[model samples]
Target: MWKLERCPPHTGHQYLYHGSEEEELHVSRQVGAWLRLQGDASISRKHASLKVSHSAQAVKRSICGSIELKELGAKNGTFVKHSNSQNSAESEAREAPVFTEEHRLSSGTEVVLRHGDVVRFGLYDYCYRLVRCELLVATSMLPRSDTVMRDLLLLGGSYSKEWTQNCTLLVMETIKLSAKVACALACGRSVVRPDYLTQLCTAVKQKQQQLPATRDYLPTITEASIQPDPSLFDPNHDRKSVLSGKLFLLSSPKLLKRVQCIVEFAGGKCEVVAARHHSMIEAGDAVILRTPDDANLPSQSPMAAACKVVKRAGLHVVRESDVVLAVLYCSTERFCNPALSQQVLVSTISQSQMQQQNTGIIYAPETQAISNSPASVLSSRSNKTTRTTSAIIPETPGSTGPSSTLIKSPFTPAATATIARA
Candidate 1:
């Protein structure tokens, strides 16, 4: 009886991540990686040979969504076959599967493994193996293989006009390049398709080009004053503070409500109004933002307006702040794509706050006053508890605990916010 070596061609009936033997297979031949099946099965193929291995506990992930697979050095090199035969060489090399969501390994047949190749199992443990064969080259370069492939894909013309206009491809490709290959490939064929890769490349390129050109001027938020509409504000002719200036809140409607509640509870009254058109804000104002759960929203929604506000007002309101207690309620599961979640996490990372320091437009937890207001007490709690209300005219509800309220001191520097609505 020939014992399974458990080495090189380590044929196993089970997977570390999926925990099964009969798994689905999708290979990106270009990058020499495979995508894990969605069901409970593990798959292994040998390059240049006719044997394939299977198990029952394999995991599954998506192309552009959650779950990913990466390859480790294995005796059998994973291959991704394409639909078109005319450009087989070009397609084979370019479509060489790494852990990318652009292309899946459907339709194409799995090839036998040889030396210097790799195979990835599933998402949980993200297990992978490298078949020790003479063909194995330096494994160090594989870590950055995605980057080189992206550059190559961009230069090779594998995207479309819609992808460029919409900026989907580039973003997706950027993520693929950033992710570990072993984890990417385990996601399986659903995430290893051709159209997906092309789209990702296009979107990423567009975003890279749209970066702000100058730090001095940002786009206007809401310059057109609604002061004429008495319904918009109170008619306090002499009373200076009345939601008079504008602020841009670049947050989701849900989060906006929560923050507003916190402010009101803390005795600070501010209006959650629509952003203005091309309006610039004064320093010492607040800009609140809720990181977009969907990657497409930031590019499609009021994000452009917020960017304009930031450029002109010299302010950027981040999500995590200590001066103005920002509460975070995001979970990794809410996002469809892990890459998109990562981007949100990066944008929302917590930052330290300085006491009584005011930073303009982008609300740094400083207590600087952007506008001048006469002294007036804002009563939040009816009892002995003290509530700090903002001088801004619009009033909101009151607070319950230390974690809910953000108090702005009177001595802080003055700033104004400018908002715009699309």
Candidate 2:
């Protein structure tokens, strides 16, 4: 059952009178039970229907929609959003969903609701959100008919576009990256393939040219293990930087995929180091993330029993959800790429550190006062190395990504969001 309240077409908070997983909650003026929008005259007696789902891993599509779209493949299930005229309040609106083709929503169609979703109803366009979600453990006490369905409550999801936009943004991320990769590979087989390959090779050379020479050097990791912002990423300070860096998610694959999406959207890269912390120190260098809780973890998840490896690595660990919002929030940075940073100096791992790490020991970089002038420093190899101050290496540069830092913050969103839609 899904309860919705403080919304239009209803007088107060109302419950869906829980239904079986085999059944859906139907909202209609004509239907007295379930949810009834009897107060709104502009809405059809049976204006729209909603279906709720719980398992994220389950195939989210409904057989009620077109099979063609299902065949096309959507990693997550397809959802709908009703398009309203600029003047959404006009009661005379006649545009309705185009049902000629299932799963295909033309401009003004009402969307079927999904997990963590809320939608609008009636000419006044009152919105709702899946605000309170709880898994009932004592379902045995309830009637068997309704017990199979996952219970949900959506209330006043939002009057503003924030919620919907965030959902849309996250959803669009997979679309964006997959499309780019598809195009890249497809083009690689064309006559332009040689040129494309050459361009990539040339770009790599250009990157190496920009990088300060790699010398065996120890970094001063004054930055806290999980600290997000340093003197460099202050958005108010207003400086250009390379936004692309690496993300290390020492957590579950589910979290890895989500964080990877956000990182790709931000033009960065990410790698998942499945909690075998010592094997991959660089994974924690740039940004480290973990699954917020064990709720969605799979059986035998490698991230299930991870310890303080993130903290000891001189990197801060953030929640999985925070990573997306934080990265999106960090788009405020002027310099968006690490390779394009003022100067990137990669700190290669020494054999000694690797050996020590295997024994479950972690070390923070020793703080050193950077010299004002270019100076020669002794490499671990005992060779003379010359470099400037203020360069930090990006963590996990070798990981696979669409290529994206993001400033760390408690992450209060701006007064307004960057995404707005009609």
Candidate 3:
């Protein structure tokens, strides 16, 4: 299994669909995606295709292991974006009077894409990655005659730490800059440089310090949540410490105040009342409290009737154990450390960085996150210019076989270690 992860999920500005097919799976738009690129005026009806096929090997291979992005003949053709390894060549190259002449990607050609192969179009670029490379490659033109393909297909390769760090840093920096640009524009700061992307890479290398390796797993603190300290019942605690997200407690009077204090201590806006304060539950709760078991559902009413009452209210009922999970998922702004989340993201990107690790790839058929598999692929070309670039697989061997590209970190040995540890 291999995947193409969209760093910042929203690829375009607007969205639309006929009312009839709104709920269909793989619902495609008239614009902006593998489903179609109709959002921009510079695009044509059928620019290119993102195809999955059996490797164009001399022999048959069991695993249907190749991806082809073939051009459909149009103005302003496709290009493959290379990393900073060739900055000088890139600057001079794109500035050439014509784009596709030096390296031509003619229509209907198959590019056996590797991980992090950035495919460029008229207005946007997308990165594709091949996972489980050993098996996929074994079946391709790259002869299984060697141990390289044999080991990958049989024994998994130990991911290169240095390569992982560099690629992770590059992806992270892009994600960060994209966010920064968005924030700047939101603050009415119109000026921004796309080149800041590379600078971000440099800065991350400078500021990052080595951290001790640790397990990466979601925390299970919900079940063991601490009761509010007795002193919290103290009338003197600062009210400003209330958390940002709202929490509404709709349960027994005995559990109300203690729960409210606990939630508030974590900075949530808690709403609770004594049992005598209400009859039926209130309507405004974004998240409503429910007991861990049916024992607390009101001894007076039958379980079915109580469930009916809850179902009518449009409330997301969560147990006590879910409190912490909810806060982190919804509003991790105040309580949780931002550093932890960064570490998690960096680690995932590092492990799956296309240039290094190509094993354990899975096709996620989702618009926002990898899910099943994309049921629809959309592409459009420009009607105006005939431009294209040779598909570049960075640092790949000999005569430009598209299956694999192993990239090295640009950081010094000292910085590479620290970045990897971080």
Candidate 4:
């Protein structure tokens, strides 16, 4: 089966319609049998017809079919914006152009619709997303005449006019209702119980309040906080001691306790500071551990003010993702190198952006030289340090004497090492 769900910017009562295989569903301003779309003057009396067709080898418990949208001869035309998943590399590389742009369907013309496709009727602010519905039983076996959609909407508290007035609440409630209804239908229950829906919605609302808000700010490395610890340089010490000599100034309130625990457990120091206490940040090597909510901070916000102070001081501003990566790989050497730090920041930002967009694109980071193994990362860091330093000494393969070489360490100004050959 297929379902058409009303998208955001709700102008009228929320709309949700279901169509079975080989069924022709009509969309118009009329309220009789047709999917009613009100408050849109651009919608004609007979706007469009959705022709549903099932696949030859349709699975019993899955949505497997296609929908052909036929445009009626109306004053305005039908337009569609294909989903991001369809706009792949192969689609772009083809000689024939994919419908990357909003494509209009000529009168009497038909086009096959894909899942997540947003269809608009005329030029007004009315749009609906086409979605697939997977049911446990066959479409033919289910009751043809029933109030399942209406009951589901009412049970989820989204069928009221007041609910549709608030666009954000409408969308959120609709998503919740859709999930509950889909689960019930998948389990062979056409109707969702009101008690069960109420319980589920309450739990979901509580969880949403607890989760962190999403933000768009990407962490950039303009300055490197290279407080090198001799313990970190030594391979014999445990990797948890990598943060031995560093102090972190955390500004994000939501992630303050969580990040503080992580930093303290790794043998590092932490200080909590607000916007008024800019002086406290001076003592810390790295200021401001950026979180997802940082993007939403206004200029007048305390967190934003603290970030500006960190920027002006030219201190390293670490991201939550970067901290996780450093802890996972058990190496802070990348943060010491400005170039490597920038690379890591860019890769993390790309990954976050892709996830936000839900594009399902795989991002391969460019740091091929950096491996996951702590031993390999340590070897690479040593080789890189040796190459950049002015001091150079070649070991005689047959010699048995200890050779002295002078090299500069990131933590200290300079360090001397003796290499013994057998």
Candidate 5:
């Protein structure tokens, strides 16, 4: 079944349409057995029609197929706002009617409605949100006493009541009920029980506990083990600055201090900005906005405003997990591709260091060999030997000769002369 509830700024009234019973529903101001919006002069006599098409295999009492909305060539026009389950942040940022007078739908143009879609009738403030309800069996047929369904509903109601009374962070909603139904269906059962919810919650908590905390185990960048860009070795430079030159804009107020500490420790700059001041967002700056895990944010809230600004500026919005992984890997590239493992990053750095070492090697100029034996000196000169040396070799503070001298041409005149002079 699908119900259309009036949106905000309007009366909280809903019109229900059962797919099995109603093939079509008419909305108009002048009505007899139709969805009538009284006292609204903007609405046409035959404003729009909702055509319900059910799936061939749809079970009785369950919502299946779709509802097609068609405009009846009204003067004011009809508009729709689609519901985006994915990228809800972006959707919230850019929430607006999909149609206007200039972009009005043609007569008989059909639009398939989905759950959460809002439809505006005419040009007035009158709007209705389409809501879907999944009731697979008849209400009278459902077991009411001493059944798993009854027990689960009772348990959920109790938990909800307790949470409300105690002012706890937990929230119980229809999604939880839907999840229970899904679990029951998966297990070849017709209903959910309280024990199932309890077991699932316990298993979820255990899994959460087993997961590693990214902040605690992030790898620290060390100068000794890895060679960074030579410019980073300036006297004022921070050795631990892996996120140098990057700027982060935090949208969530709660994560300001913790995220600031982490970003600064890694040589990155971060600051929390008000949603109104989103114009300050620069091109290279990344917005760190944590997705709400519990429920959808109110459209008028500051977080939604911030999301709007981010969306308008086309700035990169990353999650806390992405920031953590990027810091752990010591590469801003990891921001977009956080799936990369720590071992892969370590191996990549090692290979980079090896390449730098190989490319930075400075070989000594070929030296002419002077020996007591003319034949030996001639042979050395003809060979034209060169010695490989490090560009920045480490040495003892008080050492006179090279730490480890390379010997070549045993018959050299220098060694022979020293021996004869001794």
Candidate 6:
């Protein structure tokens, strides 16, 4: 299969929506797609009007025996991002942009011909399919089809690693600057360049990074969990006890110490684990939240497909739920989105209550569960913007102590937590 993806150029203080079905809505009403332009096109603000298409009115591009773009060159130039290669012969063919003024393609832009490329346009999302080049070239209209297309084909292609690295740095810097500007405004400083979205391409690139890579799969981890033997729940088994199935946990790393105190007090285990790969959700595992730079893992990390499988299976369709429990490390200071905060609160409560109730003990309301802070009361100021942070507060109280309850880790006691009976 072929793959293709696209990013809209960030041009000044402007807005572009992926699309909308909700009738009449403002530009900001749309979700996901956004860019903030900053500086000039040289140092920063480089805007390129290109939209790579999988299927267009009159074109088809492919690679490795797959059709990458159904229709690449439309209104704006369709640019194909390529990876650099050596060997003049290989370099020449792979590097050239396969476009025509007859088709309106130019340098600094090339419709890549790679298999399994994920192409993202307004609504045309498709994977490359291997098809005959003879079929393609014969069908496409051109004065000198062989000459122009062949020359374009011979163009050397490689990904702009420097472009990516520079864009990444610029994005991080922009985010930092945006945060600073926010802080300054909070402290009553002039918010200059607040609307200058010239720096938005960097943000988009950063967002792309935030998206889970196709190579790896793991739902966001919001709390700590463990995997214990399923036999622990067997009535005939000679297990010590069966703890409550409910547990409440904080998802933020900053509040890990607090979560640890709560878990320990609740007579439960507390340890860090990676966000489970999508493949591992079925073994009854508990997800753990971690920072991205925290690189403490073996090469063959456990892969679980339960979370994704269940999600794709339409668990929400059956349950009608929106709050997905991911293992992410965010803060309370910037945690302003009510919908997100609501889900986080529910997840934490479920973790704590499950641990308390599953430990063979029913927690009574009169019982002094670990003291927890309310999430709703934290961010009452901003009604428009949603910020991400890690300073989550523990607002509610849960059961604690040996008499209180205990549930073993969900997976391997030492490995990632798969769900298990107390």
The lDDT of each candidate is 0.26, 0.29, 0.30, 0.41, 0.41, 0.23
Please give the ranking of all candidate structures by lDDT, highest first, separated by commas.
5, 4, 3, 2, 1, 6
lDDT string for model 2 (1-422, tens) is: 23454434344554332223455555455656355556656545545554443331221211111001011121222233333222112221454322122233232343444322334455444444332321111110011212122211111111111111111011010111121221111111111111222232333323222212111111122222122222222122111112255445446454455345444544555666555444454353344454324436665665543334534444334443343333323442311221212211111112222322111111111211221221122213222221211111111223122211112211111100110000
TM-score of each: 0.19, 0.23, 0.22, 0.29, 0.30, 0.17
lDDT of 1 by residue, 1-422 (tens): 00111223334322111112343233322234333223323333321212223211110110111112333332332332122222222234555433322132332334433222333332222233322211001111111334424432232222221111111122121111111111111111011223333343444333232222211121121212111221211111221121223243534554454334333322233333246533433344544443322124555456555555555564444331211321111111221111223334333321111222232222111212322332233332222323222322111123121222222321212111111110
| Tens digits of per-residue lDDT for model 5, 267-361 | 67777656545555434344544422202557776656766665565443454434443443445664422233444543454454443322211
Give, for candidate 3, the lowest lDDT window spanning 10 residues: 165-174
lDDT of 4 by residue, 88-151 (tens): 2223345433336788888998888875687898887667776543322211111121232222
| Global Cα RMSD, each model | 22.8, 23.2, 28.3, 23.1, 27.9, 23.9
- Any runs in candidate 2 off by more than 4 Å, and if so which? 1-243, 275-286, 295-306, 331-422
TM-score for candidate 6: 0.17
Better TM-score candidate (1, 5): 5
Off by over 4 Å in 3: 7-34, 55-64, 82-104, 124-422
Which regions of candidate 6 are displaced past 4 Å?
Answer: 1-258, 274-280, 283-382, 392-422
Q: Write the per-residue lDDT of candidate 3 for residues 118-173, one digit (tens) a residue.
A: 55554444322222222111111112233332222222212121111111111110
Point out the worst 10-residue segment of candidate 6 by lDDT. 316-325
In model 4, how large is the Cα lDDT of residue 132? 47
